[model samples]
Target: MNSSFSIGIPSGRNSSACGYCSPPGERSQGESSYQVAGFDAVQLTCQTYQGMIDRGWRRSGTWCYKPDLRASCCPQYTIRLDALQFKPSKSQRKVLNRWNRYVLEGEPDDAAASSQKSRSGKSSTEFVLPIAVHASEISNLSDESPTHRFEVTLEPSTFTEEKFTLYKKYQSTIHNDHKNSSAGFKRFLVESPLKDEPIPYPQTPPPYLPRQYGSYHQLYRIDGKLMAMAVLDILPTCVSSVYFMYDIDWEDHSLGKLSAMREVSLAREIHEAGVDNMLYLYMGFYIHSCPKMKYKGDYSPSFLADPETYEWFPLESCRPSLDTFRYACFSHPSHSSDEVITDEPDYLQVPLSSDDEKEIRMLVASGKRNFVVSLSESPYWQYDEIQRECLPCIHGLGIDLSKGVIFKI
Candidate 1:
């Protein structure tokens, strides 16, 4: 896939206080305390984004970065699930059945519905005794009856009062995040750099279902009322989950877990409809040291990307390493070694390949502020003399070498 978006390159190394592991007097001896320099761009292609994610990089809005895994007190491993083989757990299935029942039963009276709304004025239709009702309702439900009541719709993310309202409520009620603001919410979730590239599959959804695009909000609505939403990047190969927020009143429904399962199901549906390589659902980083984040591994048949080699290993195989060392480099047998490929300055010994050099020249000539490359090692002049040769062209093009994107393989 050709990339239509350009990215600025970050020059020089930069780091900041860690959000997950930084607190006065509570920091561990070897805990990673910072995030290294990363790319800040307005746009990127799905292919480029996928490559970035595979190499352990993530984006918050448009800023792309990778954690300093080696130096951080709490290391984060990128985790993804094979959607084609996913089988929902008993609890997960119950959540789905419950939501389906509510959809089929029709909307309750305004009085009952209004009572369920939160203080933020968001309506939440609770499913009390959903399991018991499932047993009673299952006998009467026909084979053709919709097993899922909620309709999952995908549309390109845009700023909206409804979404902002839901986000404010979720952050304040669930995480006690009082600092959330509409501007921050728009910057974090509404803004996306990836271009819209809807899959060319036929539209066969039930009547009233909206068509999907590239970067979107996967909305779960029951009887036309929004209950949950997931920010996702639907790429050619996989559907990357960026963030999820729901009404706090529906906490018993386990919407987080159900959202994940639904994403996997969506991946399968896309692949079955002949969209190639759409088989995995990226669940983002799994922080072993963070109890709240450890739940990412609960979804079985998952794989973790090795921070050193950029290869993936099964979560089960990677757990032992994480158990012994806070940061596990799966490229090595033991996670204790600090030596990894990213640390090598001369890793790219040869001069930039002719093709890459030409492409860089073209990008520079075109005045594209940002570009993408498969960086296996950091480009530094100290180790590789060949890198020095390219410096002239880079400088001549007025590209800021100090601030650029560098992916360590």
Candidate 2:
């Protein structure tokens, strides 16, 4: 185990803020250094954070030094796994194979995602790369045991300009079903603003500013062509997800999950070496109403940040609250316990036609009383799931699920 790593907080409107990707780079400056057994910090500055350590921040169950900075509200957290304890899921294996196959054979399998469903169940060649440990120290885990053997090197990377061009081309190259999928969201990210007035985003992909922001970017390539890229920012506490993009042709390969898996492994390795408090993969916001966003909940041992408390609440405990359109943040062990949840504006109502109102009156007189209940009042409704299963279905109803239901005269 090696207790060698840098610490810092990333700032600005980076991907880490919105759960897209992470920050990049490493720079070291004179600062207060924190020390623990087996490791010593060289550059620790409370006011400024710069370190030469350039490992892209990893996100998962736990991160060692989740930074305490306000600008980086959502710091990248780390997921530490007992690597030996990990068993790849079916989808995970498929993705690993896809990357390997690409490495073995040349390009031209751009339409593979369509047929990926049929390519499951078999184990592909195992990817055995040198253990590229970036942290400063690596020591044997057990005392009085045979020397544990491991190799540390920079993980080979294959990012190039040609791949970036290819990625843009493949962006629109998916099945019609999924064409309108994440693309719509990407359009929103590029087009939509917090208000009607749009703030101009980087017109051209900004030059990789690793130093200015203390972020890392890694591009996974097969045969010299970029297949996927992850931009990360190493924060003091957690490794926040910025954005992840993969070639639509490679979706079946599950590059997205694989990248996440790698991050988990990295985080665990570092935590074992001594970044004790590093835990958790902050998967941004989970809109239960959005079917696409539900996958985020699949992560085990996951908790949602209580809107009211800014604390992390286990998904199990918070499941009931996600039903309504509005919610407040709760509390987490990482957060204070006295936090309270506040109500936000919500739409929870059923539309009523004049005739429907009259019929309701008749029903009331006939002893078939009519009542309207807001989703928030139900206490059992989850906004994310409802939105996924029933949307526009409940759309035009001036419904304020958080407010009282209107009764017809």
Q: Clashes in each model (backbone N, CA, C under 3 Å)?
A: 18, 73
lDDT of 1 by residue, 1-409 (tens): 2446445443323455655653521435543364444656455666667767776777788766666576566677889998877665556655564554455644343544534533434323343322222332333355645433555567788988888888999999988898988899989998887766556566565332224446788776654567789999887778899999999877866789778877777777777776767879999888887777888888878999887777889999988888777667888866554322234234234355544443442122225453334332224323444343333223222222212323211
Candidate 2 lDDT by residue in tens digits, 1-409: 1112122111111222223212211110111121110111222221122111111122221111222111222222222222333455555554554554443333335656425524663343343311312111123123322122221212212344554454455555642232433344333222211111111223332222111112344555543446666644433333445456667766766666767665555444434444554344444445453445666665555665443223455666666544422222234323322222112213224433434323221101225654333333332234454332222212211123101112111
**What is the C-alpha local distance difference test score of candidate 2?**
0.34
Position 220, candidate 2: lDDT: 58
Residue runs of model 2 more than 4 Å from their true location after superposition: 1-160, 174-213, 328-409
| Global lDDT scores for all candidate models | 0.63, 0.34
